[model samples]
Target chain A: MSLKKEGPDPKDWSGYTVGLNFGMSAIVGMLFGLWADSAFGTKPWGVLIGLFMGMVAGFRVMWQATMSNTEELGEKNQTENEAKKTDKTDV
Target chain B: MSLDPLHQFEIHKVYDLSLMGYDISLTNQSIWMLGTSLVLCLLMMVGSLKTAKVPSRMQGFVEVTIDFIQSMVKDTAGKEGLKLLPFVATVFLFIAALNLVGMIPGSFTSTSSLYINGALALTVFVLVWIIGLFKHGFKFFGMFCPAGTPILMMPLIVPLEIISFFARPATLTVRLAANMVAGHVLLKIFAFFCIAMGAFFAVPFIPLLAITALEIFVALLQAYIFTILTCVYLNDALHLH
Candidate 1:
C-alpha cells in the first residue's frame, strides 16, 4: 500500500527525532553521572551534576534542531517568494 | 499461555563457541542477523542482475530504496556526503531488513538488543570522531566551541557541548532499541489478549492488527531516523558546524 509509495520527506520526518534525542540524551547523561559517582565516590553530586548537564545537552540539541528547521524553511520561503515575483514580472 | 510480553526477546544460544576468553556463541539474535543479511544480499543481486530501461518490480523497489537513501544523505550532508552513500545505504537496508524480519512470528529482533544497537551506534560515533579529526585535524575540537561565544561562557558551554557530543551514540542506540522493544512488547501484550479473549477474540484482534500495522511503520521510521542521524553526524564531522 503506502509502503510501496514514496515515503514522507526526510526534512519533515527529521522533526520527529528531536523528542527521542532529547530524552535519550538526558538519560545517558544521568547514567554517565551515576558511573562517575561510583568511580569517584562523590555520592549524590555526580548524579546531580550529570542530570543538569544532560538536561542542558538535551535543550541544546532541541535548539539546534529548531534552528536548522527554521533556516531551511526560511530559505524555501525566500525562494518561493522570489519565484512568485519573477512570475508576475513575466506575466 | 504466559502473558509475559518480554518472553519474545529472550536470547537462546544455538551454537556455543569460545574465542580466546570471550564466549562467541551463535544465538537466535545472530541467526536472524545472518538471515536478514543473506536475504538482503540475494534480493540486491537478483534486483541488479535484471535491470532494464523500464525496470521490473524488484529492480524498481531496489531503485526506489536506494534513491530514497541517496536523497536523504544529499539533503542532510550535501553532495560531498554522497561519498558515504554505500555505508549509509547498507546501514538503512540492514536495519530496515532486521526490523521487518522481526515482524514475523517467532523471529528474533536483533535491533531490540542494546548490545547490537550499541555496537552499530558506537561504530557511527567512532567513525564520526575519526573522520572529523582526520579531515580537520586539531581544528576538529573547534566544533565544541561555536563560531561566536563570549569567553565567559566557554566553561559552561564547552562541557555541555561535550556532553551532547558524547551523548549521540547513546541516544542513537537507545532510540532504536527502545522503540523496537516498546513496539514488540505492546504487540505481544495485545496478541495475548486476543488469544485469552476466547470467543471474543475479535475484540483484541482488531486492535492487534492496527498495532501490527503501526509497528511496521515504526520499524521503517526508526531505521530512517537512524540513518538520517548518521548522515547528520557525518555532516557535522565533515563541516564541523
Candidate 2:
C-alpha cells in the first residue's frame, strides 16, 4: 500500500551511469564479436551483436543500480521481518 | 590556454620491458597507482600507530574513516562483512584519495584511464566472484535465476542473466572512469570558458567557482557510490539469493 505513496525519485546520476555501462559493454561486445566471428565465419556480425548486447547490458545495469539504495534496503528488511513474523505464528 | 578534453587520455610510455617475446610499457598510470597504494599504506600505518584515548588529528581522521566504512559495511553487507573491512576500506580510501588528488593542478586521474579502472573493477569483480563461489560453489550461479521466474522464460532469461553477470565488471569500470573523466573535463571546459567569456561580464566566474565545488562533491560522491556498490555486490555474493 505504501509502495504507491513512494516511487523512485529522479536521480541526478541516472543517465551518467548508463554512459559508463555503454563504454564497458562495448569492450565486452568486441570480445564476444571476435568469438562469434571465428565460430560463425562472419567477420563483423558477432562484433555487431556484442555491441548491441553490451548496450542492452549497460542500460540494464543503469536501471538496476538505481533500484539499489538505502530505501530499497529498508524495504527489503521490512519484508524480511514481516515474513519472519508469519513463519513464527505458523510454526 | 587551449583545451583539449581528451588530452587527459594521452599515454606516454614510461619504460618498455621486453620479456618472453612481449613488450610492456610502464606508464604514467602505473606510476600513479603505485604511488597511491604506497600513500594508502603509509596512511593506515601512521593512522594506527598512535592509538590513544584522545585521538590526534591524523588519528582522528583515520578513525572517522574506519568508523564510516565499518558502519557502511555493517549496514549493507551485515556483520559477516566486518572482517573484510580492512580490504574494503583500503580500496575505498585509495580510490577516493586518488580520485581527489587527480583534481589538483597538473595531476592525471588514474581512475580516468580505462586500464586503471578496469584493473580495480576486475579485482573487485574477481574477489566477489571467488568469495561467492567459495561460499556457495556452483550454486552461486543460481543468483541470476530469480525465485519466481517462469519455467517457460528460462531459455531467454538464463542467457540474459549470464550476460548481466558478466556485465558487472564493465559497469564497475565505466562508472568510476567515466565519472572521473566527465567531472574533470567539465571542470576544465568551464574554467576555460570562464576565462574566455570574462570580457563580457564576471558571471562566468560564478559558474566556474560553483563547478569547482560541484567537482569536489562529485569526486567524493563517485567514490562513495563506487565503494557502496562494491559492498552491495559483496552482499549479493554473500547472501546469494
Candidate 3:
C-alpha cells in the first residue's frame, strides 16, 4: 500500500470508494429500473430483475476490491521476505 | 422571519435565450461557473506570464496546483495518464472554484445540482468508454469479464461486471453533487439558526464559523478525491486490470 515511503496511503481513499460504489450501483440500477417502469408500463418485473442485477453489481465491487487487496498483501509479503534475505546476506 | 435555507439553489434566469425550443438562458449557476472559469483562467494566464527558474509566489501557487493534479493522475493512472493532466487539472480547478465560491454569500453553486454534476460525470463516462474502445478496439468488451476467470463462471461474472461498470458514473455523480448540496444546505441552516438567535447569536455563530472553516477543508478534499477518482477510472480503462 505504501507505494511511496513518504506520502499518505492511496489505498485509504480507494477502500472508502469500494463501499460507496456498492451503494451507488444499487441506487443506479434501481433508479434505471424505476425509470423503465414509468416509460414502458412494466412495473414489478422490471424492478425484480433490477434488484437482482443491482445486488450482483454491488457484490462484484466488493469481490474485486477484496481480490485486489489480497493480491497486494501477497506482493507486500514477498517483497518483505526478499528484503529480509538481502539484509541477512549483507550481515 | 422564516428563513428558507434551500432558496439559494433556486435558479433565476438573467436573460432568456431560446433557440430551437430549447431554453439556454444564462442562470445564476451558469454565471458562477463562467465567473469561476474566467477568474481561474486569468489567474493562470497572468500568473504564469513571467516564468522563472524559481517561481514567484503567484507562479508557485499556480504551478503547485497544476503539479498536484498531475502527480495524482500519474500516481493512479500511471505515466500514460500524465497526458491527461490538463483535463484532470481543469476539472479539479473547476469543481474547487465552484465549491469555494458557493461558500460566499449570494453565490450559486453549479455543482449543487445533479443536472450539472450528472452531465460532468456523464462526460467522463463517455470519455472513459471512448478511450477504452479506441485503445483496445474489440477487446474493450472483455473488460466486462475479469482476467483469469474459469470459462464456466464467465456467464455469472460478465453481467455483474457490466452492471458495476454502468454504476461508475452514477457513483461519481452522486458523490460530488450530494456532497456539495449537503454542505451548502447544512451551512445555510446553521447560518439561519445563528442569525435568528438575535440575542444569543454568538453561540450559534461560533459553530457557524467552525463549519465554514471545515467547509474550506472539505472543498479541498473533495477536489482531490474527485480528481483521484477520475484518475482511477481512467486507469481501469487503460489497464482493465
Q: Each prediction's TM-score against the native?
A: 0.87, 0.78, 0.87
Residue B42, model 3: Cα distance from true site in angstroms: 0.5
> What is candidate 1's lDDT per residue for B101-178, written digit by digit as tens?
999988999999999999999989998989899999999999999879899999989878888888888878988999
- For model 2, residues B84-123, the per-residue Cα lDDT tens digits are 8987887789888888888787777888877777887788
What TM-score results for chain B when candidate 2 is compared with the true chain B? 0.91
CAPRI verdict (incorrect, acceptable, medium, high) for model 2: incorrect
Off by over 4 Å in 3: A1-10, A31-43, A66-91
* Residue-by-residue lDDT tens digits, candidate 3, B83-189: 87887888889889888888887888888888887887888788898989999998989888778999999888876777788888887787888788888888888
Candidate number with greatest lDDT: 1
Candidate 1: residue B28 lDDT (0-100) = 85
Report the CA-based lDDT of candidate 1 relative to the real structure: 0.88
Docking class of 1: acceptable
Which runs in model 2 stand beyond 4 Å of their true positions?
A1-34, A40-91, B14-26, B198-201
Using TM-score as the yardstick, the better of models 1 and 2 is 1
Tens-digit lDDT string for candidate 2 (A1-91): 1112332232323444566555666677667778889998998788887777766766666666666654576888999999999999999
